[model samples]
Target: MANSTALHSNITQVSVDSNKNIESLRMAYLILLVLCFCIFLYFLTIILSVYFTTAHIRENTRYVLFVYMLINDTLYLVLGFFLVVFNIYVINLPVPLCIVLVILSLTSFMATPYYLAVMSLERYVAICYPLRHAQLCTPQRSHAAIAIIWAVGFSPCVADFIALSSSVETKYFSLSGICGRPMLIKTPMQNNMRYITIIFSFTMVGLIIVYTYIRIMLIARKLSSNKSSAFKAGKTVILHAFQLLLCMSAFTSHFTETYLKDYFAFFPITNFLLLMCLPRFLSPFIYGIRDEVLRKYIIKWHSFAITLG
Candidate 1:
């Protein structure tokens, strides 16, 4: 009786351990798969939409700023695709590759918020001071602003690249033929500086939206005679503001995922799809039709399609 009881207890303990190991493995795979799938899908959607949206924009001079926006976004998506795939599935990207990936990833993250700021400021000026709009917001100046935004985003990446290139390999994997590179070589100053840029960009964007919306609301109430124009302008402003706030929320949520969650539960796929890629694609559906010409074109396009069908 004693021997039989001990045998039964041992079997039960083994079964429990097996179940625990299986759960752990399942969770690990889920996290990895989610991260990989989410990033790939996000980048794929952004690149396609960016390409198609800007392809027919003939007036290069007028569309230079938007071109810059698409270019940076394209670069971001392209780079993000590789890093997410390699990091999760392969898990042993080479040291040099890692450096390039990190540079690209950081560059995209830095570039994103500034473009949002520039976009908001452009809308703010267009609505708040239409009299001086032509003089102050010419195509030449727009191009220059876009250039400056990109330059600011690039500066920190350049510094980080210098830091990364100097890193010595800390680990190697013969089977994968890959090596790990140190992440940061800078002190508090560089770290603080980079984050400051992000904070400043997002803040400037938010400030512009808040101030402009308040002014628009008050003006709309007073100038009720220009009600149609005011309504259209107000709608546009709100849409822009909505777009920015949603994007900011997505980014902040992603940052939170790093420390607040466990390794395999990132769910980068679901959050990023809903938050990041969806917004970019969705904004076009909302605002592209708001443009008088684009609205007409879409209507005509749909009619043409219907007739053909």
Candidate 2:
């Protein structure tokens, strides 16, 4: 009778512990949902603030890229949110639709780093070569450069889309399983291509950004006492570097998850959302908050709304 009573007591304790674990998981997800909603609201404010700001912002080439970054970031966040919701709701997505979703996701992922690289290069040229700036970085040329970046960014995704479409196995399209498992599994050749693309593309762009920033800093050092435009330009470049770090953190964390999962086995969904989804929102927020010019505009508009209310 004692043994039977002890077994019952152990079973009850196990059930209580299981319930506590389940409750903790639910609380974590609730916190993530609140964070996601807050980010969405912040994103909308940034978009609206930019839209209503003065013509100077609208006309500037750098700001043009900022706008593109926001749009791309929005697309990225929306796609991520939809995927999570779909996974939770267990809504079945069609095969072709899944392929399209994956392609779009890859395109956004590629465009972000390239955008930051271009922005860094722009600052570098503007700071290091003031004399040739007008001739070299004209509005028309800037637009063309942006177009080229987008095209190059999308190229790898297009290649994959074509390869996937041409595959004899129709099962590739049915990768809509919960936890998004099938998409993570790639052939050895695909893995090689991904590694090569990430290494080559990021290394080239990363080197360019680092070299350009170093040159800009050297120029700033020579005129350290001036407190002129060069100083402001250096500040802007530093902010860009922060944004780049955030962007790269997302990418690195994502790649780390697959390796981490082998050890942890039950990685939380919050990890992916925090690392991948959150960083995408940080770039525009840094731009809006750090730049004096942007800050003034946002503040002015914000005050006007308050007074009117």
Per-model TM-score versus the true fold: 0.66, 0.81
| Candidate 2 residue-wise lDDT, 135-206, digit = tens | 776667767877887788778776665655565377756654553424543545555666677778777777
lDDT of each: 0.59, 0.69
Model 1 alpha-carbon miss at residue 10, Å: 14
- Candidate 2: list runs displaced more than 4 Å: 1-20, 23-27, 30-37, 88-91, 171-176, 179-181, 184-186, 224-227, 251-256, 259-268, 307-309
Clashing pairs in 2: none
Clashing pairs in 1: none
What residue runs in model 1 are displaced by over 4 Å at the alpha carbon? 1-68, 163-190, 251-256, 259-266, 299-309
How does residue 105 of candidate 2 score in lDDT?
A: 70
lDDT of 1: 0.59
Question: Which candidate ranks first by TM-score, i.e. highest?
Answer: 2
Worst window of 10 by summed lDDT in candidate 1:
173-182
Find the candidate with the highest lDDT and give its number: 2
